[model samples]
Target chain A: MNNTLKKNDMKTAYIMLLPIVGLLTVFVVIPLLYAIFVSFYQWSFYQDSIFVGFSNYLLVLKDQAFYKAMWTGIKFALIVIPIQFVAAFLFAHLIKNLTAKVGGFVKTSIYIPHVISGVVASIVFMFIYNYNGGLANYIVSLFGSEPIPFLADVKYALGSISLPAIWLGFGFTTLIILAGINDIPDSYYEAAEIDGANTFHKMIFITLPLLKNVFLYVIVVGLTGAIQQFDLAYVMTNGGPLNSTMTPNLFIYTHFKNDPYMGYTISAALLLFVIIGVISALMFRLINSKQVED
Target chain B: MKKPKFLAFMLTVLFIISSILTGCSGTGPAGTEEEKPDDSSDSGKTVLNFWTPQWGDADKEWWEKNIEAYNKSQDKVEVKLEIVPGDAWDQKVVAAQAAGTSPDITTMNYNKIIFSAEQGKILPLDEYTDPAIWDDLYENIAEFVTLDGKHYAYPMLAEPSAVLFYRKDMFKEAGLDPEKAPVTWDELIEYGKKLKKGNVFGLAAAGNAAEYGWTHWGFQAMVGQQPISEDWSEATIVNEPTKELITFWNEMYQSGILPKQPLGGYTDIKPLAEGQVAMQINGSWAIGQLRNDYPDLLDNIGVAVVPTNDGNQDKPTASLGGWTLTIDGNSKHPKESAEFIQWLLAGDEQIMVDFFKDVTKFSKFTARKSVDEVLAQDSEGANDPWRKLIAEEVVPYAVAEPIYAWEVSMAYATALERVMLEGTDLEKSLQTAEKEINDYIKNNNYAGTNPKK
Candidate 1:
């Protein structure tokens, strides 16, 4: 009877899993495989496909634009992840202690940017970063400096593109971190306080250590999200002044439009996929390996 | 670990996320704002899925109203309309074709449609369209869509790539001739210097790569139109006249009369309309924008052809660009699409005339000579001085936009951008552009693939 019950439970679980697994196979697995197949051939939007083997992959790996875009994406993630981490942590901690009414109001206000579409946020940032006759330039002028070409110049393009992304993503990260903080038991903090711990000491010892899994989730998600940014950067810079702001997704997207570049573009996309996968794995390994070190 | 605290944290997190998600709904300027295409044909009539690039508000409304009217007028075919955002239109169309869900009919530029024609992805309209319809179109505009004696698309209208729009007040203030716009590259610089003042730029043109990429075709026409060779064999952008043209622009760029950073794109006349700059090199459509938005400033605005390479006014400083109707290769109802194209653009002169009117007072020139004749007699057509000026002085001298791949144009644009903005070597920039184009050509085996053949 126990064996039969176990078998029934197994059958039920498998039935429950079928829909999602079927969906994953259909939507994700098939497309990925198809993309891989297309990457191996000199396929085009309108022309006949010519089997080119792995020449496309080899060519994309050597292409300077591919490297430039990858580096830009990495740089973008690096800039966004650290700043988002610190800001979200700080805001979450501060907001966690406030009275319910005030905390709710602040939380809601902080989260507004998360709801704003990337397109709208990018547009808003574009106005703010306008080279002349803009709010940023106005502030600079007050300091007696020339108006900085925020979106226009290569020097400031990447950072300028990152600002909107940071603003848009800031609220979600803060909220998630706050939830993680809230999940910690008050008893730990109480015991730390009894052991001569102040708020700062308790926070340092009790909060950060316990929130390791949350930190991993946020970092891995945020890094990958920032690296794949397309709409925000495309809206603000269209990968220009120079391509200083071209993320991996934008680079792949631009290549996909130009005809006869289908094979080459797909190869680049797969390379980007690999890059993202590797980054995610490295993040998981780095974070999980920490284990609070007892 | 406490459920109560976890619940409280979740509430806070959810509230916070509400504000953070403000970036979710809006689309980028060039990003997808897709309206659902018709999935299945209605009742019994044939369904034609028609896609049009994003147009001005008035034009968009006109398209919607007309397509609805067209559908209502006929029971044999039903036209379903989808307006694709201009920036994403090309990629979406190509991708749709690749996926075998291509639209039955769509708006295409004559230059761009040629490549699709060569690929056997576009149907030759001549097979289904009457020859009389072809004869009604202006010879110059019609010639672009007709390749190897086959008409691939139907011409709607054409506009010059660049027209010199200046503030007459600025010219008067600077003691320059407001009546006679600059006719030569040298004169442009001289006039620009006189107009320069504190907090105001002397001139504004396409200052960045993408805008310059589009506007450069006109500039290429100014020198001579061999940006590539006649036989499509090699890049000819480094020739002497073109070299001189780039240097002249670079010299003007370096002369400090123009703003270091442009206030807007090449097609935007907002800088001129708002009085941010004294002179703007914008398309002829600026007349409509100025007429519609800044009428008070219209009297102060002067419209002129962009300066020729030499002092000759007959030389084109701009290229003609306009949309045409094309039937998809995979279209199930080619004959119906051809009939629809004919009924809308070619059959009725008044319909095309109304289209010109809806687009704001003939800011765009008509492609059909019959439509042109009708407009030439109407109040806003021949009577509108700006229209008259553009039609006679600008349109006559303009060359058709080149039909090469956008990548070739972008390479040249980037090269010119690096040279003009960063003061890089002209020789190096040209060499880089040439190499990039050659590589693209060689990889694609581009020889004898010309649609004109």
Candidate 2:
């Protein structure tokens, strides 16, 4: 009787898992595989696709635009990761310092941007960055600086694109880091105070060491999220001022439009994917080794 | 334990049922209607799907009114209209085509008509459409949409892609003739300096990448040269005409006549109407927008052809950029869709006239000459209120927009931009464009593939 009951329980669990597994196979797994398959073919919309083995890959490798797009992604990531981490850390500390009611209000308000759609955020920022009458120029003029066309110029464009995205994403990271901060025992800080440790010393000795896994999570997740950012960049600038801010996704998108071939775009996308994947895997390993060390 | 098992079993069944119901509910009322039998008349109507891009207020209203009128006017066919927003237009249309759920009919830009024809995305109208309807189109309009001697799209409206719009009040303030527009490129810069005041910019041309690239084609027309050869074989930007064109625009920018950064894109007349700029080079559609949104400023606005190097009114100063209605190649009701396009775009002269009336502009507007006659007699165009002046002066001179790959056009635009904004050397900038175009042509094996040829 006991054995029969266990079998029934296992059956129910498997049934619950079925939908998710099916969804993964259909949406995620199939597209990835197909993208790989199409990366070997050369043709556009309705034209007979020629099976050009490895040529598409070689072409994408040699393509200047592909390299430029990848470099832009890397540059964007470099700007985003450090700023996102620092802002989240400071914000989490500030929230921790505040009273519960005030903290809740502040936290929710900061998170309102995150809850809003990326496209909406981008549109709002477009107005804010407008050269003539935008809030950014308005404030800059007050400091006796010439008004800048923030999104419209290459020099300021990538940096301008990063600001709104960072503002949108940092709230979630702040909340996560805050939770990690809360998990640390108050007794540790109390003991540190008793042991002739100053506030900075306690932070260094107690807080930093304890939030190791959380910090790692933030960096890896933030790095990956920053690089894959499409909606905001695509919406804000449409990868313009002469494709200076063209993300890898937007590059692939424009290429597909010009010539709607599955092969070249897929090849470029796959190569980008491999590049991003390797970095992610390396980061994952770092996280695991850190976990082991901890 | 047996009771627990029973509850779990019920839960799984409930979940599956809910999922199915959710999927069904997503389609709402429109789903069932769309799934109706194709062209069989089993339901007493052949359901034809028509997709249009998101247009301006009046443009959207025109569709809403006409599609309803067409559907109600006939019981044999029902046309469903979907307005795809401008930004998402490309992606949505492509996906629909790929999925074989493409609309029976849709609107397309003239530039992509050839590419669309080559890909078999659009069907040839020569077979399904009336020959009289083909004869109704102007020679240029007919020639523009033809690929290998077959029409793929039927034009809806043709707007001269560049027209000089100026502020009469500002012109007076600068002690220039309030009625006269700059006729020569040199005169334009001269007037621009006088027009520049403390806060107002002298001119506003396209500074953004997308708008600048397209608007530059009109400048190419003004220069009396198509930047790419008609054969699509080589770059033509290194010549004297293009040299004069780029140099004039660059000098205008470097001299602080035009804004360092444009206040708005060329399609948008907001900056000109708001008095941010004394003059702006925009399309004929600006007249409609100006009349609709800034009625107070309409009286102060002056219209003229885009100025050229020698101010020769005979040369083409503008390229025709317009939309065309087309049938999907895979459409089950190609004949029906063609009939609908004919009925709307070419059928009743009054209905087509109403389109120009709704926008408040009709200067050589319609591809159909019959509609032009009706518009001249019946509808008062945008603001100019003059008939046949644009038709005579601008329309005849305005050449058909080039059908070369967009990469070539945008490459030349890049050259002009680098020279203007970054102050790159003229020869170097042209060299860059030539290299880019040559590379694209070589890679695509694009020699002599000009369908327009």
Candidate 3:
């Protein structure tokens, strides 16, 4: 009678899984398989795509612009991830200690930037960074320093492009980290305080270790988002000032939109996807394994 | 309990029905008709879709007035103008064509018309149009729209090559004569050096790679190098004159006369409008933008022909940039569409109203010589010196960018960008461009197939 009940439960479980599986097959699996298939051809909207084995991959590997873009993306991710993580954690911790009303106001104020569209943020940044009339230049002028070409110069282009992303993204990251911080039991902090632990000690032991899962989640997701960054870069630099700020996603888009090499673009996209997937998996594995020990 | 459950179910059904009714009714007000009237019922009445990227407020007002006039005069065809945004319009039209549901007619950039023709998306209107009409176009304007001995579009406007727009006040402050602005590459450098100082650039030569800075304004204006050969077999001009042009611009870069390299502020005409940049090499299209956005700059601004090489005393070559109207091959009403296009391009008062006053300023010369004459007569001594320069000097020297296969042209633009932005070895960049283009042609079986020749 128990065996019969188990079989019935298995049938019900399979039935319940059907909708999700169907959705996954339709949206994700089919498109992914189609993209892989299309990657072998020289595609254009105007003409038939001719199959050309691994040529697309070879071209992408050899392309100097692609190399530059990849390096830029890596630098962007490295700079933004740690800065964002620390800033978000600090802000969230600060908010956690604040009075409820004041904390709410501060949170809402920070989160406002997160709600602004990428295009809007980029345009606003453009004004703030404009060479002569911009606010940044005005501030610098007050300090007796010469006006800087923030977007125009190659040296500053990457940092300028990344600024808007950091501004827009950090707020949301802070909110997520705040949610995780709130989940921590108050008793842990109280116990640490009673033991004569300092604030830093409390943060290092009570806050960091307890919020490990959320930290892992934020870092992994943030890195992935940085890798696929497009809209802000597209709107602002347009992969310009000598393509110093170009990313792989921008490279793929240029291929798809400007050059009609959709096949090669898809191949590049798939390569980026694999890189992101592997990194995310490795990160999740490391974090979960560490959790197992804890 | 049973009665309550039944009542709950009844309420749920009522909610769904009301939601559905709301959705259906939301598509329109309660009583408006859903379908357009049949065109066949009225013999002389035709409905045409005219698509353009210049659907700005002024453009729309002009279109409505001219379309109204056309509808009133002929009683033949009623034209509806749909303004697609510039950035996505080309892609949108391409998708529409691929799906075989394109609008009756649309305007396309002259550089892009060849690609559309090559794809068989646009009809070659040679057989349908009167040969006499071809004579009305400026010599190169018609040539641009012609592919394989067939005209694919009705030429609308022609943006002549680059001209020098300078701040008269800045010129005065720099102790340089506004009327004696640089007329040669050497003189431009000299003048630029003299004018360079705080919060000002001597010139704003496009350094934005994506804008084809080197190819359009830099090389074309410097030594009159065309982007591709007439036969479209190879890129012919990336040699000495091109190298010289790049080197000249590099000199300007080193001089700190041009805006700091990898040019920003190309889109912000306000800097120039506010007298921050003394001189900028740009198209006539900027004239309207300046007039609209910086009215104060008008009194202090001067326009002149692009400077020539020291020895090439001939007219400086202007890059022709403008749109051409074409009927989509997939158009449901090809005959009517072609007729509408012809009417729009007609040498009548309607063309003047539609092309000049209603639309912004003529970014370029109107395609029709008659229209050009009318514009010149209308604006004779109108205090706009830039208009005078465009009318008398810029229009006559205008040359269109070479037409290659779409992919090849795109590669050329990319190569130009690399040369200007990265300071990449010009020869190496050109070689890479040539190889990529040839490979594309070979792979696509486009070799020896100059569709636009």
> Each candidate's chain A: what TM-score?
0.95, 0.90, 0.90
* Candidate 3 per-residue C-alpha lDDT over B1-453 given as tens digits, one digit per residue, 9 for 90 to 100: 444665466456544554553344322111112222333335665677777885356666766777687777776677777777766775676555433456678887787778778766688876766787888877767888887788889887776646678988888888998777787889999999888888788888565665663235434544756555555555554577767766776678767887663335443455577666788877777776776667766888888777777735356556677777898755556777776667777547446544564365655467787776666566542444666667767676665665555555555566665665567788888787777666665555555566654
Q: In candidate 2, which residue ranges exceed 4 Å CA deviation?
A: A1-15, A43-47, A193-195, A286-289, A292-294, B1-42, B379-387
DockQ per model, Cα? 0.18, 0.26, 0.19
Highest DockQ, which number?
2
What's the chain B TM-score of candidate 3?
0.80
Each candidate: RMSD to true structure?
7.9, 5.4, 7.5
Assess the local accuracy of residue A226 in candidate 1 as a C-alpha lDDT between 0 and 100.
93
lDDT for model 3 comes to: 0.71
Instruction: Judging by lDDT, tell me the better candidate of 1 and 3.
Output: 1
Best by TM-score: 2
lDDT of 2 by residue, B215-285 (tens): 88777877767667778788777888887888998888777787765676678888889888899988888
Candidate 3: list runs displaced more than 4 Å.
A1-62, A189-206, A289-294, B1-48, B69-78, B94-101, B213-218, B221-238, B261-268, B293-296, B311-313, B347-349, B376-385, B405-449
Q: What is the interface RMSD, in angstroms, for predicted model 1?
A: 10.1
True contacts kept of 3: 0.21
Candidate 3 chain B — worst ten consecutive residues by lDDT sum? B27-36
| Weakest 10 consecutive residues of candidate 1 chain B by summed lDDT | B26-35
Cα error, residue A188 of model 1, in Å, equals 4.0
Q: What's model 1's lDDT at B375?
A: 82
lDDT of 1 by residue, B146-221 (tens): 7778899998889887889999999999998889889888899999888877667789988777787878887887
Tens digits of lDDT, candidate 1, A165-204: 8988999999999999999999998888789999889877
Residue runs of model 1 more than 4 Å from their true location after superposition: A1-8, A44-48, A186-206, A290-294, B1-43, B72-74, B225-227, B239-242, B254-256
